[model samples]
Target: MQTEIIIAGFGGQGILFAGQLLAYAAMDNGLETTWIPSYGPEMRGGTANCTVIIADEEIGSPVVRNPQVAIVMNRPSLDKYEPLVKPGGLLVVNSSIIDRTPERKDIQAALVPANDIAEQLGDRRMANMVMLGAFLANLPVLSIEAIEKALQEHLPERHHKLLPKNYQALREGARYLAEKV
Candidate 1:
């Protein structure tokens, strides 16, 4: 099995972190994976994105022209990547910020109000994890437990105290999506 995913949003939205968590989880599950990140110069307000590929076999390329999954956390990201999703692919949108719907009709779109949910969860920054939860709820590629474990690996030791909040955010997002579906 192979999956190519693109996660995008503003620089401070933890877009790269989400992609890194997914990559780490894939590796933990013994899958071949690649994560490539890109960002603009404006730092917090600039655009940031990452491409992650997870496969059961060796990956041949890091470039993803048409991703199987696209997680869009902002209007610019949605506008840029929504149409690039392959037919029958999944488009996960952070509806807390994006009100517009995708133009494509061939793919499945999951809308999660990630920012709002994160705010409710007591921290707006966890919105990325909320989006990640919503995205993973639909795909059985990795278990939630695996993702939590991967999160530990990606976060620095000093930040370990915040893991519970992040874990809760992930579960909340997944629960939100499950209810929506």
Candidate 2:
């Protein structure tokens, strides 16, 4: 199986980091993965986006003109990439920033209050992790155990203590979805 996901937001929102973590987790699950980040001239306050591909077979390209899933962390990202998701695909939106829903009925969408959830969990920085957890819960290609292991291996040495918090954020997201669904 192959899945293409695009994570887009303004810089400093951890959009790229979220993509990298997802790619790492996919790789840890023995899937072929590719992560392509596009900062372009928008490196500062402008829009940033990353395309991550996870497949059981070889990945042909990293560029995702139309992705199967999109994780949008801001209004611009939601407005910019919402049209690019395929039919029946998933669209995960950061509801704190984007109050509007996608106009298309072809895709399934989830509005996650990531920032608020992260803040309640005691670290606003784990907003991305919360979203990642929701993504994992919605897309079951990578197991939670594999994602936790990947997080342990991928987190920087200096931030090792944050792993448990991140894990908690993930669980919270999962629980939120469970309650909603």
Writing each residue's lDDT as its tens digit, candidate 1 over 73-152 gives: 99999999988999999999999999798889999999899999999999999999998888889876787888999988
lDDT (Cα) of model 1: 0.93
TM-score, model 2 to reference? 0.95
TM-score for each predicted model, relative to the true structure? 0.98, 0.95
Model 2: per-residue Cα lDDT at residue 132: 80
Q: Rate the local accuracy (lDDT) of all candidates.
A: 0.93, 0.87
Q: Count steric clashes of candidate 2.
A: 0
lDDT per residue for candidate 2 within 25-128, as digits (tens), equals: 88887889999988858666777889999999999877788899999999988888899899999998889778787788989888899999999999988888
lDDT of 2 at 30: 80
Q: What is candidate 2's local distance difference test score?
A: 0.87
